[model samples]
Each structure stands twice: as structure tokens, then as C-alpha cells.
Target: MAVLDIKNLNVAYKSRNEKVFAVDNVSLSISEGDSVGIVGESGSGKSTLAMAILRLLSENDTEITGEIDFKGKDLLKMDINEFNKIRWKELAVVFQKSMNALSPIHKIGSQLEDIYRVHEPKIAKQKLKEKILSLFKLVNLSDRVYNLYPHELSGGMLQRVSIALSLIHKPPLLILDEATTALDVVTQGQILSEIQKLEQDIKMTRIMITHDMSVVANSCKKVVVMYAGKIMEVGNVEDVLIKPTHPYTQGLMKSFPTLKGEKKELSGIKGFLPNMSEKNKGCIFAPRCSFVQEVCHKVAPKEFEIKSGHLSACHLHGSEIN
Candidate 1:
């Protein structure tokens, strides 16, 4: 069964003059224990989609339409009080900037204690400490980190703490928005490995938002390719990330350098993203597509099933790519 079902979710930042579309008509269903990665360059609405699901976006300037159904409840329509109860307990997020996410003034253990107490208030102090310490060990943190302030810990350590805190609640759905972006390449790999290890025992669905295809390759089973605020492809990582069907997904794969196999010069997709504030009738990636059809510039393409479990939004299909 699906743990989360998002139907035609549209998120736009509105101003007095115009509305900038960040996510438009995007629909996805995430099943339990699925490790899905949403990959795209900056401004592709990957983070925006995560924020919308978490209800972190400010309603004053941001207009969010459609449903964010989480475990049978509509998160978007849920009351703020009720949603707060569900946020970290059932669904949690670990952001890239770990330093900013944590409290600098308080020691790590105390801060974690406060968070745990909010949701699980009746627990004894000794039991809470034991739980926090156990979580630290799970994320591979040192016992010394409990007394250290946020600034005292290294960036990697801080991120580990953040991960531990998120996992403390044992949330069913964990949305990690660029969680490994700010770390060094080696540190990123270590963190990713740690996350994967956690999965073996956690039994939780994970959504990894990143621009790195390799990250998806290393961690996720399924991949969602986003460009210009829309999903270009969605399928198993082997089908979508390895053998991409959409031109944009193909471009993304080409742009990145591969560590193994035949070494070749990287190819970049030429052309900037279309303005989000302006209205466009065509596929937003048409300007940069190498195999663009004439209709691609004139009409928006609906998602067509490319394989048994793969889908793409392009006039062209996978067979025509070769």
C-alpha cells in the first residue's frame, strides 16, 4: 500500500505582480519502505515539493494546491495543531544545513531531549537519555557529542546528530532535502552509507532529494527526474536513472561524470531554465532537448507509460532516443 500519495500538487510563490510556479501538476505515490530519490538541478522544485508535504511553506506568499495524502490523511488540509503532532513523529526531514537546523546555544543532548519530550512527554528522564544515546550509536556518533554544542561539533558530526534526532522518533517517512550536499565527497559517501545501514533496521520509506545521480544510484531504488518544476521521469533507478527515457533525464545523466566504465567527455545541456513567472504552452525543457519534436515547443506533453513501471512526460519515448 502507498504511504504517501500526492495528486497534481502545484506550489507557486505569489506576489503582488506575478506568481512563480515551483511545482506544477506533479503527482507521485510512495509506497512503504521505498527509497526514492528526486533528482534535478537547482530551482527544479525538489525542495519545494518536500516543503509542501511538510507544510513548512508559508501560506501568506505561497499558494499550494491539490492533495498531500499521507497514510490516508490529507496533510495539506489537516489542521495545524493536528499536523504538528504528525510532523516529526510520523514524518521527519533532515536538511542540508545541519548547523542551522540545530540549536547552537544548547548542548546536543538537551536539545534532543526537548524534542523527544514534546511528542513523548510521559517518558522518564533516564529512559529519554538512554534512547538518545542509542540513537547516537545508530548514526555512528561518539558518546562525547552529547555534551557538545552545535558549533563545537564538526559539520559531519553535526549532520550525524541531525540524522540521529530525526531517526529518534522512528518516523515512517523520512524526507531528506539535500541532506548530503554540504558535506565533502568522502563524508557524503559515509553519511549515505550510514543512512543505508539505518534502513536495514528502521523499516521506513525515504525520499532523498538531490541533484547527484550517483547519490540516487548509491542509495535509492526508484528515481524521479525533475526539471523546470515538473517531473520528467519516474521509475526504477535502473530504468530512469541508468537508462533514462526523457531528454532532460538523459541530459542530466550526460552532464555528470561517471566513476567507472568507459571514460568520455561530459556533455552539458545548453539553455537556461524557462522563467517560472511566465506562462508557457510547451514542455519547459524543449529549448535544451536534443531530440525535440515540433509539437514539443507548441504543447505540454502528458505523462506516457514507457514501460511496465516507468513513465515519462515527453513527446519522444525511450526507443527513439537511440
Candidate 2:
């Protein structure tokens, strides 16, 4: 069974004047031990999708629809109490900023203890301390660092601690929302290597959400490309990253730098994401797409199968490669 399955999931934010749909009818299934990357530019709702899965959005500002099934349980229907039971046990989140995630005043050890204290109540305090120490070792931290506060550790160490805390319960799914965004290249590589080791060692499933295609290309087995709150494409990482069917995907790949080749100036997508509250008549990317036609401006394109296990939402699906 799929560890995570989201179908027709839609999320909207409310204001006094209108509702803004941030995620629009997106569907995805992640099997056990699978590594999936959701890639998109900022404002494309990639982070919102992750937050929605965790049921972390503030209820007053947002409305969610459709299903978020985790191991046959409908997460959308779970009450707060039941959801709390699942948060750090069945599903865990490694948010984008480790600084914001870790508490400044609390000792690192205490924070680690809190995960077990909340979820695995049956365990005694002594056992929890032992487990937290074991977790520190598992993430390659020195035992002495456990007593240090968040400010005492380096950025890399804090991020590693954040990762260790997230794995405290050995949850089935680990959602890394740009977890390495703040680190240097060397540190990021180290963390990525550690993540790969953990995945292989435990047969864990991971969902890495990042706009960096290089990270997605190196880490994920499957890829989902999002643009303006809609999925532009989904396919095997090798196939989609190497031979992107969507124009947007192609543009993203072209923008990546290579060591052995001549360096070119990097450029971002030209136009802005359309306002969600505004009435969008057709494809959301039509304004920025270089290959857009009249049909793209007048009607939304249906998702078409470009190859086995490769699908794209573009008008040129059956035509010449973009």
C-alpha cells in the first residue's frame, strides 16, 4: 500500500474579499521506501502542499478539500487528538529553517526528549533520555553536544540535530522542506549523504521539497513539477529531468550549471505567477510559456501521457518535443 496518497487535494486561503486557491486538484501517491521530489519556483504552492499534508495550516485562514490518506487512514478526517498521535510517529517534518525549528532557550537534549514525552508516553523518563542520546549518536553528534542550547551549536550541527529529532519516532515518512537551504555546499552534501545512508539503512520513504533541480536530480527516484499551484509534470527522475516534456521543466533544466562546460548566466522565469483570486480562464503558465498558443490562452490543457510513467499537462504532448 502507498504510504501517502493525496487525491484531488485543493487548498484555499480566505480574505475578506475573496478566496485564493493555493493548491488546485493535485494528486500524488508515494509508495513505501520511495523518494519523491516536488520541485517548483517560489509561490508555486510546493510548501503549501507539504503544510497541508501535515495539517499545519492555520484553520482560520485556510480551507482544505479532498483526501490525504496515509497508510489507509484518511488524514483529513482525523481529529486534532488523533492527528497529534500521528504527527511525529507515522509522519514527521523537517522544516526549511532549522533555526526556526529548534528552540533557542531549551537544551538540545530536552527538545529531543519532548518528542518521546509527547508520543511514546509509556516510556519512562530515563528510557527517553537513553533514546534521545542514541538518536544523537545515530545522527553522528557528540554526546556532550546534547546539553548545549540551540545557540551553542553551529548551523550544520543544528540542522543535524533537527534531523535527528525528526527521526526520534522512526516515522514512515520524512518530509524535508528545503532542509539544507541554509547550509554551505559541503555541509549540504554531508547532510544529503547522511539522508541517503538513513534511507538505505532503514528502508525509509522521503519526500524532498525544493526548487533546486540539482538536488532533486541527485536524490529523488520520482519527480513532480509544480507551477502556479498546478502539477506541470510527473515522471521518473531520470526521464523527466533528462528529457523534460513541459516547456517550464525544460527551462529549469537549462538553467542548471555544469562544471565541465562553459558557464552561462542564469535566468529565472520571466512572468509572475497569476493571482489566485483573479479569474484565470485557461492554463496558468500561458502568460510566461514561450510555446503558448491560442488554445493555451483559451482553455486549460488536460494531462496527457507522454510515455509510460511520464505525464505532462501541456498542449504539445503529442507533437514535436518542446
* Model 2 Cα lDDT, one tens digit per residue, 1-322: 6889999999999889899889998998888888999998888899999999999999999999999999898998999999998888889988877556778899988877875778776888788888788777766678888789988988877887888888888788999998878667776776677777778888789999997888888888999999878999999999898788898887787777755567777766777789887657788898998899999999988899988878999998735464
Which 10 residues in a row give candidate 2 its minimum summed lDDT?
258-267
Q: Tell me how candidate 2 scores on lDDT.
A: 0.85
Global lDDT of each candidate: 0.88, 0.85
* Candidate 1 residue lDDT tens string, 1-322: 8999999999999999999999998999999889999998899999999999999999999999999999999999999999999889999999988558787799999999999989999999999999999878766677888898988988878887888888888899999988877667876777677667666677789999987788899899999989978999999998887778888888888889988999978988898888999867998888888888899899999889988779999887556575
Q: How much lDDT does candidate 1 score?
A: 0.88
Q: Show model 1 residue runs off by greater than 4 Å.
A: 184-187
- Which sections of candidate 2 miss by over 4 Å? 124-127, 138-140, 260-266, 318-322
Shift in Å, residue 204, candidate 1 = 0.3
- Clashes in model 1: which pairs? none
Each model's TM-score, in the order given?
0.96, 0.93
